[model samples]
Target: MKMDCIRTTAAGLAVTLALCSPLVAQTATETDNDRLDNAWSDIIEGEGQLLSPTQYAALNNLAFQAAAARVCDGEKLDSEAFGKAVADILVDTETELTDNEHMQRNAAVLISFGTRYGLFVAEANGDNEKDFCAVATKLKAEPGKVPLFLK
Candidate 1:
């Protein structure tokens, strides 16, 4: 009788672990995504003060890939258009980013990220150009809906 009880407890524990493992992994992924999203928002909104170069690089890479995945199709990435779109979404006319060099740097970051992410997602999704373009267009039109799209 004691052996049977032990076996049942072990079985229950195994079942619990099996069921919870995937949820834990999913939760971790969601948390990471949220962190990345927040970082991107900060940078775009000009709150990325005193961030190390490595941190900026990571954030830039993540943002670029995510944005590219949302916005670019299989065609050549139009960096200028992407920069303008991002500027429209994140920058206000009243902001003090008047220097051409600063604006250009931001634009370059966007283009680099977009290009990398676009190529990656395109290849990963079997190069479905039509779908890629459609999704990219939708994302560009509604940048605020990125979290929903990511999910």
Candidate 2:
């Protein structure tokens, strides 16, 4: 009788663990996504206001230049490729900007930042681009749902 009881308890514990594991992983992924979203928002809001039209154009040129280089090298223009290319441009543009210009130079900067973060979050959540874009679009449309970090 005692052996049977022990077996039942063990089986129950195993079942509980199995059920909870996915939930725990999902929660962790969501938390990470939230963190990334917040970080991106902070960067944009803090630096995006001072960008001039010329600076924005410069940033676009930089991004396109990076993309061209990748194509020249025969690299696949996948999400990671574009993300890294934009990231490189963002860093360079930031350095070139004057100290008072604490802003992303162009729309590409904001879009690339969000794309990179969205790709990361989607991977973590085992989701696809469709799901990611849906969530993002919904969040963007809802006023005050997400901070006004991107233009």
Candidate 3:
């Protein structure tokens, strides 16, 4: 009886550890993603020169996602889609900027492009209220005037 009880306890411990392994891995991945996001945000918000190659790649990924998300009207984009977008942008022939204007200027460009291309849909209603949803509605209303790439 004693041996049986010990074996049962050991089996329970093994199952519990096995179940927790995936959760541990997931938590680590989430932490890494969050750290990357925060670092990227800080870099963009800073008032300085252009980002390094790695930084640029990360921000480019974020920008592409922001653009593609608008293109699909809030449809959930997978990581692979965002990665492809970033890769395409990286290989484009356009010159990269390395000034404080990189963030703001790029943001404006995306907004303008999206609006001009009718890729953006504003969430703002006719109320003219200055809120997030209101702004989104207004932009979407004049999809041709708002850029899906902008903030």
Candidate 4:
């Protein structure tokens, strides 16, 4: 009876460990950078065709710079640098936008990016979303407002 009880406890422990091992390993091994980088790279590759040549080039440049910045920020060897790179992409898209609608959309994208990763020190410090929307709305109301608003 004693031997059977010990065996049953051992079996239960083994099963529990087996079930939890993968989860533990995943949590211990995986970092936020890995997920961020993967998502950003996928977005750039999949959506590159949608952008104009100028926009694509600007975004690519920003992405490259942001990657270097993230490497400096991330402490680990496999740290993912996607989040900041995506923010840079949004900034590039914002800069490339000629129309009010596109600017507003890009601003919203930037705001979302900032909200997600706390990017763009200046914009994140200020009320970037509200400023962007206000500028966009003003530009829509008066086309002449575009230059001033951007300025």
Scored by lDDT, the top model is 1
Model 1 clash pairs? 71-136
Model 1 segments beyond 4 Å from truth? 1-98, 127-149
Off by over 4 Å in 2: 1-36, 48-50, 53-75, 78-126, 129-151
| lDDT tens digits, residue span 38-144, model 3 | 43233334323222333333343344335334444453445665556544444442456566556566565344334322311232111211232333334334434
lDDT per residue for candidate 1 within 5-120, as digits (tens), equals 44443443233223322332233354332223343333334422222233333333344335445545432445565455445433433346668956765675555455435443
Candidate 3 regions with alpha-carbon error over 4 angstroms: 1-47, 51-87, 93-130, 149-151
For candidate 2, the per-residue lDDT at 137 reads 38
Candidate that would win on TM-score: 1
How well is each residue in 1-151 modelled by candidate 4, as lDDT tens digits? Answer: 5555444434432332233122212332442222333443333333322334443433332322232233323211112444444544555543455578677767655543333233322221343333323323343344331111111
lDDT (Cα, 0-100) at 51 in candidate 2: 34
Candidate 1 has its poorest 10 consecutive residues by lDDT at 16-25
TM-scores, one per candidate: 0.28, 0.22, 0.24, 0.25
Cα RMSD (angstroms) for every candidate in the order listed: 16.7, 19.3, 20.7, 22.3
lDDT tens digits by residue: candidate 2, 22-130: 3322443554433344543343344432333333333333332233233223322345644554455455543466645535354545674344344344443443333
Q: How accurate locally is residue 101 in candidate 3, as Cα lDDT from 0 to 100?
A: 51
Ranking by lDDT: 1, 2, 3, 4
Model 1 has a clash total of: 1
Among all windows of 10 consecutive residues in model 4, the one with the lowest summed lDDT is 142-151
| Model 3: residue 40 alpha-carbon error in angstroms | 11
Instruction: Name the 10 consecutive residues with the lowest summed lDDT in model 2.
Output: 142-151
